[model samples]
Target chain A: MKRNVRSSLGLVVVGFALLTSGMAQAAETYKMDTEGSHAFIQFKIQHLGFSWLLGRFNTFDGEFVLDQKNIENSKVKVTIDVASVDSNHGERDKHLRGKDFFEVEKYPEATFVSTRVEKTGEKTAKITGDFTLKGVTKPVTLDAEYIGGGKDPWGGYRQGFEATTQLKLKDFGIDYNLGPASEVVDIYISVEGIRQ
Target chain B: MFINTETQYGVVSIVLHWLSFLLVAALFGVGLYMVDLTYYDPLYHELPQWHKLFGVVLAVLSLARILWRILSRSPTILAAAGWQVAAARSVHWALYLLLLLLPLTGYLISTAEGSDLSAFGWTLLPGLFELSPALADWAGSLHLWTAWGLIGLATVHALAAFKHHFVDRDSTLIRMVYIKGQ
Candidate 1:
């Protein structure tokens, strides 16, 4: 009877350890797939006394670290290469990368690092973070929506999420061709992440 | 006779000059208006298409313009201040080169990214070569820089025109202005 009781106690300890490990493993790290990810940012400005001018940033990449047990502990990191900005014009693109605007030479990569993730509800979150562009960094908040996660055909664990945020160009030190007050620029981020 | 624009500058110059003005004006208006619209919004997405369409048109016009300028006879610089004449010639040539290069680079970049370079709602800008992500990225940057170059040049051109017309009371501005009779 004592032998059976000791064996049962051993099983309980093992079971407890397994459960703890499972809980600990819930802090999942996701690697971003650059080829599969898509990001776009749009901006509007007053044009030569006629109408509003619109432009977009065409290239960006991002990753997510999700903690199911503690959703608020989750984190996100994103990088946007300003040199890839496109508005469908050649002359204009070059101008944007120059000193008057992005000055991509001095500051090449625009990045966003999430400081906090506040879960508003199921599948919805308010992610506040620091966004740096053109050498300027500022606190920004993004509204992130869980687009659902699933298994890929390649047998890799994957999750898809979409986040969006808007900020003024001047916040990032991007001030050029803007008349009077700077225009408000809207940035959109769509991320697809896989386990690293 | 000191020729200002060569054979390559004749018809091509006229076409690029007018089309560039028109497209830039349109783009300026479209860009400004797009601020209020969303990405999925018809106007927002459509504006870039239109911009690309006009870019392709500008590219074609630029090529033809260059060919014509190379083959045809150009008007001579009869009389003008030496600096003014040099500025006009250089700026015009720069504008032409930038106009051609910018659009071609943009098209190649778009093609490299596997993006459909459809102009407006009708014609599709055919991809001439395989897509290269690296080249596309470089081209994107090039496109942006070129735009700034064009804007600066345009500003200089505009200021020069004003200088010629108002400050100097010269015919530089009137040279390109389409007046029925002068």
Candidate 2:
């Protein structure tokens, strides 16, 4: 009985040590500071064959895990309120949210969750993720550049990133016929995260 | 026959006049069709862009016509009473004014609604005005009213031309229709 007890105690000690070491090596979690941080997500699409129509989403929330040691293990997830789309025109915005476009009433939220992170440079990485938009999910890759990370005046650690990707509106089930403008759309995301 | 003579229109004048008439007529048709398009129409997005494209082209062409008229001498009016001459001149001048005013109001409405004027695939003008629903609505109404005025004037002008050709049995219609030295 004493031998069994000793073996069980040894296993418990080993498990505790492994758990603590794993925790130390795990990535740092960052909560999005929606008020203090700014998340600018802009999209540009061709207007006819002439100019690019620029627009942006006004509301979004996201969080990310940064494993500075093993950057490949970092993960990011973003949730965008699809109804917050604005193109500086009320009628256009309303039209966009209708069935022919985003159909925000039916699919009110869009989300992106990173599946893989490929480090390309010292400050740049390619983040591949599954993006759910308008009830459809597709894999998208974004070129992300880590701006910097430092402690803020409020005594919180913060990190900034800028990511860009090109997507086809048709892929998201937003296949409105814009003639020559019905091509690919460029998406830009600039976000800052605060360490939780 | 490149310049206008007292007897008939020259090549340049004839070409500009016919081109403007055809384009303006087509624009009026397109404008009428596009305004009735609903948000659910498949052409809701595309038709407006095309309308704006044609509107800009018409505006540029009308300006050129005005400049040409100013720089060159036009054929003298056929012999008529003082009141007939006055009525014809007023109608012609009103048509010119509407040509300018209609496009200007359209541009204002489009720009105010936060849309640029593009020609085919080329952007000629950007949306420069601050977005205001009220301003867009006002400009749209003006554009519609001006379009109606243009249609009415054009119809009267056409009827008068036919009357001069068939009823009055004069060279008033022939002067613009037949080229000089033809």
Model 2, B1-182: lDDT tens digits are: 78887777777877878888888888888878966676458886687777777788788888888888888887777646788878888998899999999998887765665667664577878877654444554576799899999989999998898888898898778777766455
Query: Candidate 2, residues A92-151: lDDT per residue as tens digits?
Result: 765676677888767989999999999999999999999999999999999999998899
Which digits, one per residue and each the tens of the lDDT, describe model 1 over residues A97-147?
767678887888899899999999989999999989888889999998888
How would you encode candidate 1's per-residue C-alpha lDDT over B50-137 as one tens digit per residue? 7777777777777877776666665554336697678788987898888877887778765663445675556567656644334555
- Superposed by TM-score, candidate 1 places the C-alpha of residue B43 at a distance from the truth, in angstroms, of 25
Docking class of 2: incorrect
Over 4 Å off, model 1 = A1-24, A38-58, A179-182, B1-182
